[model samples]
Target chain A: MTLSLDLSHRFQGFTLEAAFTAPPGVTALFGRSGSGKTTLVNAVAGLLRPDRLRLSVAGEVLADTTAGIWQPAHRRRIGYVFQDARLFPHLTVRQNLLYGRWFAPKSPEAAQDFDRIVALLGIGGLLQRRPGALSGGERQRVALGRAILSQPRILLMDEPLAALDEARKAEILPYLEQLRDELGLPILYVSHSMAEVARLATTVVLLEAGRVTAAGPVAVMLAQPEHAQSLGLREAGAVLQGQIAAQEEDGLTRISTEAGPLWLPRVAGEPGRPLRLRILAQDVMLALQAPQGLSALNHFESVVEAVHLGDGPGAMVRLRAGDAAVLARITARSAKAMGLRPGLRLHAVLKAVSVAQENIGRGA
Target chain B: MTLSLRVSAVATVVSLPLGIAVALALARGRFPGRQLLNGLVHLPLILPPVVTGYLLLLTFGRKGWVGQWLDQWFGLVFAFRWTGAALAAAIMAFPLMVRAIRLAIEAVDPKLEQAAATLGAGRFMVFLTVTLPLILPGILAGTILAFAKAMGEFGATITFVSNIPGQTQTLPSAIYAYMQVPGGDAQAARLVLVAIVIAMAALLLSEWISRAVARRIAGT
Candidate 1:
């Protein structure tokens, strides 16, 4: 299924004009705060009326301002999981989960399997409790269940984990991944964290100041040197699709990537399980020649594809390793000294310990 | 006492839906005539009770426009009847009821309502399931206040419906009637004590009900 949206709205200080079509899977709207991610999602949910909008999900027209057809939110059948879990304070968790069913369209396909949803969210224990009593993660789980029980045509999540603490986020991320994998539901996930986008998104639509700067598959988008600037210099990175090749006897796991075999601290997974690794540009170093006696475990022979110089002393160099892309941030002085240019071959070195466990996820 | 209770109860019950409607509108609506509607709802509180009664007399009295239609068609007369006392009391207590309910409604977070809508609930369903349940404390407080105001309403009741024993004579009117006769002081004093007792009981009952409902809604 595909979800397409084209909308333009002028606020007091900001104007949003964004259009993108997302294929099935998690399409993340990635931007900084006030970049209009939430506004775009709200317009799609029918909560906000834009000056001009045309939105449809899997061939069903949700809104068309030109035709004077603006479906009310209740009839749109689009589920929204808000940043703050807005569960009914007066109802028990079970009631809140079942609330959407009360007004849901009466059809066999619209009916959600209650037992399966509760089990999927692991909220069966919370059924007797109220929202005020649930922890943040539990509340979010209940909210997710409530939205799913509505049998929406599509799901819109607006920074669902932004309100949680690190521990709570860790507690909830696995459930989100399960939803993404098992539900087969088209999810528009909004977030500002590069780590989340790298871990969860199948596609990324980069937003900058209310405009969509770039949109493409996750691996390709994150590797673009121009797009890295908009993704924040600190978060500039490339995603590598790899598989667990072996677990060595010396407390290390080998991952086979297009670049080459990468050895990292042992990660929990069976051999041959696909994994996505986010290698931040800042964490990579370049050598003009294959260096000797290097402590770093990862060394990939690559050719420099492009050099993007920042305003400061640093420069971001994009390299192609076989079919994969890798980014390295080095001082301009070093780039000048090495005569770095497109098509120049070099070695990309990385310390295995610099790869945070938080930036790794099971890939599709 | 039975007539007083019946009149006040009917008035409180009758005006409740209108009070909630007006309160929700005042708290949530952004219409052009919002301030005018607010002022009109509150006019009875600022105007003299006698003048309010006179206005009611002009509109709902037997010979008045609405009252004439009611009398000719439905035989429902508001002038000099207990129903008129209830109507007058409802009008006088309306502002207080709306004020309490409006404050309660304003205290509710609109985001919860939006969430309900996204869950496929329509406007009225959202109000019924989310808004009304959340504001039960305010509704209880408003209803008790209106009931207490109706029980004690005398100036308007006496002016429009007059002090007719067993019909329009409420607690305050009965007390007023007893005060004008010799040796009626003891009876008037007794009624005064009853009024105080009933008012205190109503206040305590309202407090208990609201606290219970608040605790339930708050999940405390």
Candidate 2:
């Protein structure tokens, strides 16, 4: 399924003109604050009647202003998870989750399916409790459950985890990953957190001041140095799809990527389960030959896909390791000495990649 | 005392739906004559009780146009009757009820309504399930306030429906009648104490009910 939108909305002093198509996966609407991400989401949800709009989800026309077709918010059949959780305070957790189901048309999409969703979100214990009694993470889980039970054509999640603290965010992120993978539903996730975009997004739509600056797969969007300014320089990195090969006896976990198998500190996942490999550009190193290892494991043969030199002293080098793309941010002086160009074959080294913090996450 | 209670209870019950509707319109509706409607709803609150009663008499008295039409068609009369006292009390209490309900409606977050819409609830359904439930405390408070005001209504009831013993003479008018007589001090004092007790009980009852309601809504 694909969600497509063409909206032109004018605010008091700002104007937003955006048109994009989101594929059937987690497509992150990535931008900073006041970049019209929320406005666009609201427009899609029919909460805000944009100055002009033409939106369709999986070939179903939702709104086309020129054609005088307008579906009110209640009839849109799109679920939205707001930043504040917006759970009905007067209703219990179970009632809040079923609020939408009451009005949904009779089908699997709108089925009560109560016990399954409750167990999936781990909100079974909270069924009898009210929203006020739940923690931030628990409330978000219930909110997600509520949106899903509504049986929407597409889910619009506007910074669903933005209100939670970092610890709470970590607590709820795995549930979101489970939702993305298990639900098999398209989610248009709005966020400014590049790390979240890198972890959860299969596709990235970079927004800047109400316009789409770039939209592509996660690998290309992050590895593209031209987007470094919007996607923070330090946060820009390569996102790889990999599977767990084995758990090494030395407390290391081997992940099989398209490029080759890379070893990291013990990551908790069963063998053959998918894991996303997030390598910070600064973490990758380059070599002219297979150098003897100090602590590094294997080197993979790769070609220089693109070399970008900025005003700063650092230069970004995109490397093609088999079918996968890896980004290495090396010094401009080193690039000059190595004569790195678009097509030079070289060995891309991992240099014992650190698993500090959120460098690895569950696959979507 | 029974007459006063009957009048006040009838007045409050009769005015509730209108009070909520007017309050909603005043708080959220964007239309012509909104300011005029708001001012008209509040007229009884600001005007002297006697003035409001005189206006009601001109409109709803048996000899008045609407009152005459009702008498001829439905054989109903309000002038110098217990029903007229209820009418007076309801008018006097309208402003308080509208104000309380309006403030409650304003306190609700519009975001919750938006969430309900996305959940596939139409506008009326959203109001029934979300808006109405959330404003229960406010409604209770408003109703109690109106009831209390109606119970205490004196000047309007006396003006609109003359102080007729056993018919329109409410507790307040009855007390006034007692105080006008020489050596009626003891009876007047007892009735004043009774009035105080009733008012205090109503206030405490409303406080307790509203507290329980607020707690339930908050889920704490």
DockQ of each: 0.80, 0.85
Q: After superposition, how far is residue B69 of candidate 1 from its true place, in Å?
A: 1.4
Q: Is the docking of candidate 2 incorrect, acceptable, medium or high quality?
A: high
Error of 1 at A115 (Å): 2.7
Chain B in candidate 2 has what TM-score?
A: 0.97
- Estimate how well candidate 2 is docked, as a DockQ score: 0.85
**Candidate 2 chain A weakest lDDT stretch, 10 residues:** A354-363
Candidate 1, clashing residue pairs? none
Every model's TM-score? 0.96, 0.95
Q: What value of lDDT does candidate 2 attain over all alpha carbons?
A: 0.88
lDDT of 2 at A276: 76
**Predictions in order: lDDT:** 0.89, 0.88
lDDT at A353, model 1: 23
- Model 2, B120-190: lDDT tens digits are 99999999999998888888899999999998899989999999988998989989999999998899899
Model 2 stretches with alpha carbons more than 4 Å out: A107-112, A351-364
